[model samples]
Target: MDRIDVHQHLLPPGYRAALEANGVVAAGGRELPDWSPASAEQVMAGAGIGSAVLSISTPGTTFLSDPAQADQLARSVNDYAAELSAAAPRTFGFFATVPLPDVDAAAAEAVRALDTLHADGVVLLGNARGVYLGEEGQEALFRVLDERSAVAFVHPADLPGPAVPGVLPFAADFLLDTTRAAYLLVRNGIRQRFPNIKFVLSHGGGFVPYASHRMSLGIFTQTGRSPIEVLEELAGFYFDTALSSSAAALPTLLTFAEPGHVLYGSDWPFAPEPAVHYFDAGLAEFPGCDEATRDAIRRTNAAALFPRFGAVPAPVPEPPLLTRLRRRARTRIFRVIARAAGRR
Candidate 1:
């Protein structure tokens, strides 16, 4: 089917060994699914996806606290995945992993992967060692990514809080992890500032689309300025339909995300074949869009994101003039209210 899957996952042998050494037998509290290039290819064919952009899932290099080791494991994983992509140019392209909380190493690897390895993009966790994205400390990393106009694919890792006994992190906590990242990114103006870098939040941005107004209000509550001013910035983020292609979730994601920003994603092999097929079927049957829109979401949107894959240049969207005008008008009122009273 000419679909381009933008959020497919890979498990590198060396990275798996590192996880085993660290006693992390599970990722985000779920058993890791078996993955090989052959298996991946078969799954893609079954799902009717033409290409799968591979990435190492959560508990990635960030799981390793040792900066040196993190860097080493990241480089090795990237190298391996790059080799896989190189071997199967048509079926695979990889999003390079980076050693986060180690800005220099990440930047260097990013340069290598993008330049030499010909990686499609970079995958980053929403948080590393309790440091969420858009925090002051992560600014350096963001700057490097922004310089290249890189596609920054953000995946959710385990949240720092205590885990509830019954529910798995993927079932609940993962969603909040992504939402929190989106929150911090927008409130801190990172999303606004980084126009060049395209940030794709996985799992359909994990409630960001549904709870956007609340999130915007939350930002306004903290900072005096109304988040209303940058609501368009929040919508600019790309969302992937990884385990999120449903009637319930699609409405918000489609309505809230800018057109051509929602791309297809099958969270395999982490999702396993059964689960992957379930969502793939759901996407196929979802009545959210007509043939044109579905085609755009499944392939054309991603093709726009990774031009090397399909070379379909993105149709430049006209700016939201109405939103901009509303922002300008509301900014004055919010500023007056903020100045009249100190932050709550």
Candidate 2:
């Protein structure tokens, strides 16, 4: 047990039922994954993950048409996560889920989660009902998050409008969705205005690290703000390497992220176990990461963010020979599937 995974997900029974009741059988173009606490623990143990900051993945509360229902579900999932973290304080931390697009309810839920539930942070979708963060009607929520200086984990939801036929949102649209939120947050001055809120962008901030300059230039041309300033603000966000830790992607993320800003993430359950191992191995094998840098990305950086997990005693070491063989075989199969899916 060494690394602190900041981007893991929790799929509580109640949460899953809610989605099913709402006719959402899938998210990001994939079927809902089976998840249980025991299964999550087993995966973490095998991967040498000391703790995981659990969060609800995308299509958050916005899936529900009724605001009251959305808020109720958010509260239920947050309570469930708090209980799990309480049961094993060293093994778990959680980001609270909030009912968004309804700003008042969102603010109240965020306040409750931070002040009462004691969540490490809140998980926010890139867009809620087509309203991206930093857009109008979202100020109250930001103010609450800012006041508490919460770690808001921004996850991507489905892209607005009908999906392109045969293309999955997770394959390419998720990146653009996250980039949209990042750009709007900078352009609308949310990052500057609410400087206390630590925004952790998921999937290595979508395409932000790679296309930042182009985005900044677009912002510069529209508003009088400097491109350099936009880039600086975008770079200020914390990035988690979930499924984005390939050799090609990792270097760009490391280059764009500031010291102590990169954190580990294994998007379990939603990301199949083999895919998790594949990306984890990719992170481990990248040549640019020296021992110290790897340590920071794996553990120290996240420990600094959630200090309670920093001192957890090491668990049993991962088994080597069998695990390596399994990882290699499964990773190859996952790579082929990912390539066919057109994921980068």
Candidate 3:
């Protein structure tokens, strides 16, 4: 079916070293998968994926305290991904990872990654340090992305609170992170304001489809926005089928998500090869998933978001004046910094 896996993870050599040295072993409560380009290719081929958008999943470089170290590691990972993309333009593309909480550095890196390296999109951890998405400090970075109409791939991270004794974080906590980020984006008006940026929620939007009305009503009351208005905003997210292509997940997602918003994702490495087969089998055998729906999930929907993969680019509407102004100011500042760095 020529599938595009939009939610794959890539662990670079330096990234792995940093995680281990920092005493990090698992993400979302499961052991990290053994990963390599060769192994990823084998898995993709088995699952019939034609291309994969790579990213670093939860517990990203934010584990490192020093902004210097985090910044360097982000660049290294993005550069490594760029090299892979250059080698095989058709098989691989990557979402650039940035160290958050340091919003300026992240904004700058977003520019370099999207404008210069041609990254497919940017991967943002659901919560950065302790600052979740749609909070005060995130404006600058989100503004840059809104300007570019970038694809913001939201991945789960370990929650800020201490883990409970029994439940795996990925199994439960990760879903909350995704839900929180999505709701907060709607609450802060970030989703409404940044009409151009396509926000992709991983793991079928993490209980969003099933609980959207619950979220929207609460948000509408809190923000004093009309219920239907808030409902549209809540429904605006793009969802990926990563660890979420089961008979259970797909039906709800297919029913709720807007047409052309659901994309294929094989949460690789973290999901391992065997797990990939299991979910792919489920998706293939989903009785409700007809050829049209299956094909849209596999490729067409993603192609709408990412034009390089064959789908026509959706026309971007003009940004409002405030967004335009913010974009211009950020771009000028970014240029000055770039020139200063080059001089050094």
The most accurate candidate by TM-score is: 1
Candidate 3 residue lDDT tens string, 98-208: 888789999999999999999998999889887898886688898999999999999988889899999889888999999999988999889878888899999999989
Cα distance off (Å), candidate 1, residue 148: 0.8
The candidate with the higher TM-score, 1 or 2, is 1
- How do the residues 1-344 of candidate 1 rate in per-residue lDDT, one tens digit apiece? 68899989888777888888898889888887788788888888888888989999888887677899899898899899988888888789998998886777888888888888888889988888787877776667777778888899999999987889998999999999999988888888887677788999999999898887667667877875556565667788999999998878887787677778999999988887888888877777877666777888888989887877777855845425654465467557656665655643
Q: How many backbone clashes does candidate 1 have?
A: 0
Worst 10 residues of 3 by lDDT: 313-322
Off by over 4 Å in 1: 313-344
Clash pairs (backbone) in predicted model 1: none
TM-score of 3: 0.89
Residues 114-140 of candidate 2 have per-residue lDDT tens digits of 999899999989999899987976889
Ranking by lDDT: 2, 3, 1
Stretch of 10 with least lDDT, candidate 1: 316-325
- How does model 2 score by TM-score? 0.89
Off by over 4 Å in 3: 311-344
Candidate 2 segments whose C-alpha is farther than 4 A from its true place:
311-344
What local lDDT does model 2 show for residue 156?
A: 94
How large is the C-alpha RMSD of every model relative to the true structure? 3.4, 10.3, 11.9
Computed on alpha carbons, the lDDT of every model, listed in order, comes to 0.83, 0.87, 0.84
